[model samples]
Target: MDSVQVRPMQEDDLPSAERASAVTFFEAERSTRRVSDPEAEPRSAAASKQWIDRMRFYLSVDPAGCWIAVDEEAGANRAVGFAISQNRGRLWFLATYGVLPSHQGQGIGKRLLDAALAHADGRPGIFSSSVHPGATRRYRMADFSLHPQMRMVGTVDRSTLPVVDGLQEGQADDFAWMDQLDQDLRVAAHGPDHGYMLDILRLVVCRDGARPGYAYLDDRGRASLLAAAHPETAQKLLWEALASSQGPTLVNCITTPNEWAIDVGLAARLDIGQEGYIAVRGMPVPAPYLASGHFL
Candidate 1:
């Protein structure tokens, strides 16, 4: 026996957890041929660190459950694997299991998953990994949803919208309008991560010469470009962001059904990508106006 053991995640375990998770993801990803590897080992390390940091940040924001697997006696508790879950039906596994390249075929990966799954308690979840063919197959074999891509829409060519300069000088009416929109959005999105949305949801993007546009980003990266006091301003902001994003070029403005603003995406002329569902068990049958912004 490898003396392997599993337990609730410890906050103290973050550093080691990051390392193990990084190594596991790197090699498995390499095997999968999904995304291009970063420039060099040094840059790759930085990117991994960034990713792990994000995992930690996201975990802190989880407000649900998080866990880790360890080899008790060996002190090899470098967080070889971990799982995180949230309420209102949300869970995500950001793991890098399987022993390092040299440590493979030793049953580490399988054990990690078994333990993680055991912790799931049949809860609903969505796994995040590259969409590489092999990796996709692996997740599918693991029984995750293979077709839950969000509907992403894109469009272009707005000739005369007001360009919001900066958020500093928007009028009081604009602020009041944004506040109303935010509260409306919150009630609409009853997801686990939706509660922590204020920080990400409340945004004011503006142009140098005019009013502002409020932006709400949900737990996922799906975004919503709200109706603003200044249509020209909203249009210009959308135009600029679209040019900058790796999109369907513009912002993803899909909201829950109740969200009156969900239609903003359509109004923006964004090419709504095919509707995709997240594979999971717990996500409540969505209510209304549940516009998810993005997984930041």
Candidate 2:
């Protein structure tokens, strides 16, 4: 094992962190496909950038909670592993934790995770989506229990949108209200920076008689994250998202016990892939909520 130091993530560390994440994801995907689906395609450049952007969003909002592992062997100063987390009140979300393939067995990833969680100060609640077996085990060792989770991917059916009273498409400026609604319904606080998703996603707002709700969908109409005052409102937003997607789309890292959300996905005929687990540290999140971004 190299003499690696885990330290607070700095502005200068973004590039290295991004690179390490890309490498780790690519390696993991390749390994998974080799064992489960040899015919699967490799990740595209656009996909890799999207992964980096997700991590960037977390780093942008919670730089202090993010940590990077620097290998200090023979004067080399570089990031071999990194862990990024978002501490939103009682909900501490672990966005990503990975070590370069060459450095995997050295405990660098565990060290980075420990430091990242330490920022939460033993907060009762923690959340993470674990795709790697090793990561799932480590999370369990940290006392996070596993829950059913999966990723759904498919081409959006543009014709699925149906007219629903009071459902309006919104723009980026409408994010403040949407974020407030999200915080109200979610198990944890989501910072105002959530509006960042609006820059790329199309926001669908549901105003069903004073109860306002919204869902974030890619330009083509696939739902990412959604929350509503009621299930009817959420279902309306989900349908609108299904109608808007223009091409291949996905809703990732959703907790499966949220039966309504899962049923919606099944009804829409989306293909479920890469089954994984959602690890929760404290009280588990009661579902029926939309899974959005990387942390969800």
Top candidate on TM-score is: 2
Q: What digit string (tens of lDDT, one per residue) describes model 1 on residues 169-210?
A: 233334444444333433222332333344344433453333
- What lDDT is reached at residue 264 by model 1? 43
For model 1 the local lDDT of residue 117 reads 64
- Candidate 2 lDDT over residue span 82-108, tens digit each: 888877766677777898888887687
lDDT for residue 29 in candidate 2, whole number 0-100: 70
What is the model-wide C-alpha lDDT for candidate 1?
0.45
What local distance difference test score does each model get? 0.45, 0.71
